[model samples]
Target: MGVLTGRTALVTGAGRGIGRGIAERLARDGARVAVHYGSREETAKETVAAIEEAGGSAFAIRARLGVPGDAETLWREFDRHADGLDILVNNAGIGTSRPFGEIDEEEYGRLFAVNVKAPHFITQLGAGRLRDGGRIVNISSGLARTAAMPQLMAYAMTKGALDVFTRDLAKVLGPRGITVNSVAPGIVDTDVNADWLRASEEAWQGAAAYSALGRVGTPADIGDVVAFLASPDGRWVTGHWLDATGGSLT
Candidate 1:
């Protein structure tokens, strides 16, 4: 049987890119997946259809995080489709490459609202519904540590906070047999980051060179690591910050 047979997983922001990749992987592993999308209904439905075509069970849900009561609404929608949840991947986030000085207050507020507050409350609600021995994988970024550029101050802060949440929540939920961890990916090539890379091939190559592995990371690279963490093989791992950076830290 698949490691996650009979399990249920909720993947937020799963309409595209890394989130889509992770959701697909979980479904392929025998889990009934709740594919959550913020505002991309078409992409969300497409994700669900793809899973069904692959002979996996999946359903689409819509809830924009960062709004009041959005978390509660999400769980309610999830309950309508599945009896319980075993995995929650907090993959929704928003930020920009503008320098710290250039980012206005409105932009900063929006970034924090989405990047930090959304995940915090989403996990809060998921905790109540997540079954014993559940797993949560928060998608963070390698920039949390390196601060590669001034434009990343706000984004890095949010991810740094998420890492702290991972450590603390692991302790809080440890007694309940739930595993909480963060996966920090480095410079993944996704639609979200495509424009920046396309600005210049040198920019993309520079990011690749930063990694000791000497290549840019794909969404699947991060997805594979997340799938492992959500599987039985990763049961012993919790309260850990996994570095999926292709040796970038080294």
Candidate 2:
């Protein structure tokens, strides 16, 4: 139960959904988790409480990402609680389903800002604080590889960029024993997907049918995969993009 004993983890956007699931799982493994939220203070608190109730240790931190000085503010707050970092999960991001023609520069820019730039600068600024042998897990998406949803071209592009970031960052940090990898999930039954996924019986079943598993994924499905990558078992693996898509891409 304590695979990550004595370690510390920071999960961005962990107020709910996949972020919360990752935070809970890390804590369950005995890591003192820092649950970072942008504006969902209440949900952040709920995540902390849930972890604590499960006999795990966790605290909530807030930083509105995709803004100027966001990385600084996040680290500043993190420093107040921890001296160093053992794991960093860049899970904060926004999703869009607009087609190429319908999308504007502003929308595209915001997508890249939150999904791409935030993780880039977060790692850049916080690299020093990450201890040797630490782990960095970037939450990417299966859309990066397949064009199953043409409407998500911009969103998919952002994830593709993130996968590239993971590869290069792993090389840059490998000398220090840090492992960087991208965990790409296909579709999950999270609040973010609730609107469209649950719109109709057909929509729900269609999403489930995308995966060979023949069911909609849950947050825990992705969280468990990240847990493995974050653990010592993943030490030798770096600069790779893991498919957490339940064979959806296969």
Candidate 3:
């Protein structure tokens, strides 16, 4: 039997890309997963279908983040499918649509609303349902620590806040045996990055060169790391910011 055979997991923004990857991994390890998506019902269904096809179980939930009552709405849907949560992966976030200087107030507010406020409130409201010994994995970005992409300052700012949330939350949730950690990824090959890499082969090569591994990271790479932390073996590690950047930060 899988280590998480009876555990339940919730992965936000799990419709596609890294979020979907994380959800699939948790399900593969035998956890019945809740795949949460903001607007893409099709993508969420695809994620659920993929998991079920692999002999795992999963359900889809929707909540338009950055709006009023997003967290509460998410948990409402989540509660309907599962009684309590054993793992919570806050992976939903919006990208920096343009350079920092060009972004206006509305865009900036939306970014923080979805990227920062949503997860914060989600954890706050959902923690009660998070059984003791649960795991909380926040999907952070390498940009939070490095100024590699100065143009993405606003987005980086949001992730930096998320890192802080991960650190402080671990302490708050520790007594219950819950582990909260940040997984910072660098340039995973996903749709969130398509605009940046689709420019040319030069762009793709440049992104890969940043990693000492000499290849672009994939969603599966990030998924495996999350699965490790969500499993029993990860019980002792908490409040740590894990570098899943494939040596890009080194």
Candidate 4:
């Protein structure tokens, strides 16, 4: 039996990239996964199919995280499909890397709505639904800490907010036996960065160079860390910023 046998997990933004990786990994470890996506019905279905094909249980849920009422819609469908939720991965976020001076009100509003607001309320709703000794992993970025990047001022602000949420929420939910933590990744090679990489090979190379491992990270790397956190091994760990950044901050 897998480590998460009989457990149910809900992973948001699971249509593709890191979210899909986390959903698949959790299912593989014996958790019945609820793959939540926004407007990507086909891609979400594909994730579910892959999990089912691997002899794991999974279902797809649809909700736009950045919009109003999206969190409730997600939790309702999650419980409807998984019967109960034991793990919640707040991985859905959106942002744009623009120069500080180029940032506008509309951009900031949208970025905050998706990156900060959605995860806040989603975790609020999902945490209440979690079983005893449940786990909540918030996906953040390395840029939140290292003041090394200037172009992503607005985007970094959202991640910085997530770091704060992870720390504070852990205390609030500790009494209830729920552990909240953040997994901050660096320069992951996901669809989120595909367009940026396409715009400049030099930029991609620069990203790789930042990592001590001399390579960009893959979604699976982040997924594996999240799985460990959700498993029995990570029970004693809470309210920590687990940097799976390939030593980028070093």
lDDT (C-alpha, whole model) for all candidates: 0.89, 0.94, 0.94, 0.89
Model 4 misplaced regions, further than 4 Å: 198-203
lDDT of 2 by residue, 169-189 (tens): 999999999999999998998
Point out the higher-scoring one by TM-score: 1 or 4.
1
Query: Is candidate 2 or 4 superior in TM-score?
Result: 2
Model 2, residue 176: distance off in Å is 0.5
Q: Give lDDT: candidate 2, residue 243.
A: 90
- Using TM-score as the measure, what is the rank order of every candidate, best first? 2, 3, 1, 4
Residue 11 local lDDT, model 2: 98
Cα deviation at 137, candidate 3, in Å, is: 0.3
Regions of candidate 2 where Cα sits further than 4 Å from its true position: none
Clashes of each: 0, 0, 0, 0
lDDT of 4 by residue, 176-219 (tens): 88889999998888887898765798988888999999999998
What TM-score, over all chains together, does every model reach?
0.96, 0.98, 0.98, 0.95
